[model samples]
Target: MTQKTENTQSGYWFSKIPSKNWSEKFFLYWSLVWITVFSLIVATEAYKVFYDVEFFILGLFVSLPCVVIPYFFPCAADKDKPLWDRYWVKANVWIALFGFVGNYFWTHYFFVLLGATYKFPVDFRLNEVPVFLYFVTHAYFISYHSATTPILRRYWTAFGGKKSTLKTIGSVVIVFAMAYFTAFMEAWTMEKVPYYSIQDRERMYTIGSAFYMIYFIISFPMYARIDETGPQKNEKWSLSRTAIDSLASAMIVFCLCDFWRLIIGSIINPTNSIPFLGTHGIKA
Candidate 1:
């Protein structure tokens, strides 16, 4: 088969070209739309055209494409399978589940570590935090993970050869660099949103990215493993397997974040509370 055909068949969602499956294609479009919308919103915010609540709501709306599309349109390879067995459905469910955990639980890490305050008020909330916050994180995560996949894939193809030591070293460097850059970009991009406030801008731009880096360090590689093909291909992931992987990654990050809190304490804010349940009651 041609290289192009091989890539298309690989079902690598990170590719610049569209995936062979409609479900992944739609998801790619969905991610691009939100990433663009987010950029536009950031631009508007820069011009004093603020719509913090509306923007978050839009994020929640756009995030549904991943979940909604898979129900009606399973990938071609998955047409004979059950709903949860479908590749797109499994991929979406995995990401949404991970994003949910991150927002519901890890949001507190931002509060305690970076002194992040969600100032925009909304009526619906789970534990004094906006309900849309959880879903909006889905959109953000889609973009972040999508950005990491292609770069890492390229690096792995080029440098991750038969040498296990080189592979390990290359993986470490690439993962750290990508994680740090993506974390800093998100923090910097949303820094001016008026609602998402951090105590120290300078610190957030610099050292704060390290704290956020923990999330992608765990997620980027793990998420890429979903529905693998080509040399990376093993067995396709079951929905159960997907959930287990995502949850395990989240748990690992949770432990790491708590470890950071315990050992280093808050980097941005010295007088922060580190509770097991996170900073929900800390009055963000």
Candidate 2:
């Protein structure tokens, strides 16, 4: 016969096991495995041969803030909140999906219709775009801007206290600067891996960088409004809500990009048109 005691060693073990929630457990295990694999790959020659240094630098720039800000000042949704309430996790999931989908369409336009090619390491094409490239360009970039914009806004408010014309102008300048730098880096990296047959590298750099600036223009203010954690604590968080918002944002960006292409084709040069097949008399 066994004594039924709530404080038994076996009972304690079972109790502790059940206390760990599935979402936390899943994320913990997944993070550990991902970090281990990523670290090992970076340690290998395969990484050196297959990965571009610029891509790595870009990833570092974006991912560091995403990790650090949350570490020190985590989203209110993450504190004693349910898994669905965790904005970061939800954002990542939604962005990754969007990235993959968006890349599938846009990449084909650039590569096939526009007759562009990629450099060696940066050329691991998947669904038209590079695999790891999606993480740098989409996942990390979106998350970084979404999380940082609010923090930057708060900091500016704290420093300036009351808003002024000068402060507002200064904030706009700062935001533009950040957007330009990000676009510049991406364009600079792409230039390093010259898209074959696409002469006029400077033109590519200028246009590509300018086009990417739209991402920040649309995302910064949108995130500032929708991605707040502190204000969202009182509201119920669910996967469906996150999904809807993310999808809406993705569609907005997509339409804007396509619209830009249409405008460019009509005004500038049809040869420079994006959204493949959007331009009349253009053959893919």
Candidate 3:
């Protein structure tokens, strides 16, 4: 009875269970696990890394949303259009707010705990690196998630998926692929900027890539949970639905496109090149 009670919400793809309430919690837990692992791996590799006390706690404030907000306060919608119709930019603001707060808390927490208190070769600056990274990471998440939701929703449902085991595995793959792709692009772009480098994490597949994979896998439902609740009688994207979907999709494309543009800049100007810095921002 006790085991089954806990298993009630445990679903494979999204819920890991049959949980009607606290369903989104699973995602949150995984995100924490991933970030902690990421931070620890990065912290332990002191020769290649320096911890930041300021951004540690700040990461929670902002990152919590990019990781879990959509699951909890998903964009409400009807049945005729995409969930991310016109309000995509507005959603970016919401994500940025979390980024600000998250960066504030997490940076502070890790800075002290990890003794990122000292400077490395680059002289880590809170205003420049920690806060800036939080802000940018938040923006990237908005783009990544907003874009993938529609595709995931469509893909899952299209595959004869109901709310059962099929969805659980499928959900993990979808979110993991999306996140992995995003990371790949970001790492590629970091070639020049190199602000978010992780040379030390390459070895700790469990702490870095594997941990990230688990985060995506476990949190599969948060992004797709609402859609699983069943759509309206009609299948057309509604104003809210369209808004969410389009905005999410657009933000994702926006990130990928800019990342590619960065590649182009590197190609065109070999000596002194920069990506879409002045052209557009990459906040989803």
TM-score of each: 0.82, 0.57, 0.39
| Residue pairs in clash, model 1 | none
lDDT of 1 by residue, 1-284 (tens): 88755554453334332232455456667888777876776676642443456645575677887677766665556567777656666667778888888887887777777767677655566655677777778777776776677667666655423347877888889899999998998888786677777788888788888999999999998887776643444456678888988899989998998898887777765566455455544674
Clashes of each: 0, 0, 67
Off by over 4 Å in 3: 1-90, 105-130, 159-161, 194-201, 204-207, 212-221, 224-284
Cα lDDT of candidate 3 equals 0.41
Among the numbered candidates, top lDDT falls to: 1
Cα lDDT tens digits, model 3, 1-284, are 57534333332323222231132343344446545655564556532543355445444554555435444454333123233431332344444543454354333322221112223333344533434366446645554544555456555655443477777687667777876665455444433333443334332222233222322332233434333344542232234553454345434444443443344323223343343332122111
Model 1 misplaced stretches (Cα beyond 4 Å): 1-25, 45-57, 73-75, 159-163, 229-233, 269-277
- Candidate 1 CA-lDDT value: 0.71
Q: State each model's CA lDDT, in order.
A: 0.71, 0.50, 0.41
Positional deviation of residue 179's Cα in model 1 after best superposition, in angstroms = 0.7
Alpha-carbon error at 159 in model 3, in Å? 4.2
Ranking by TM-score: 1, 2, 3
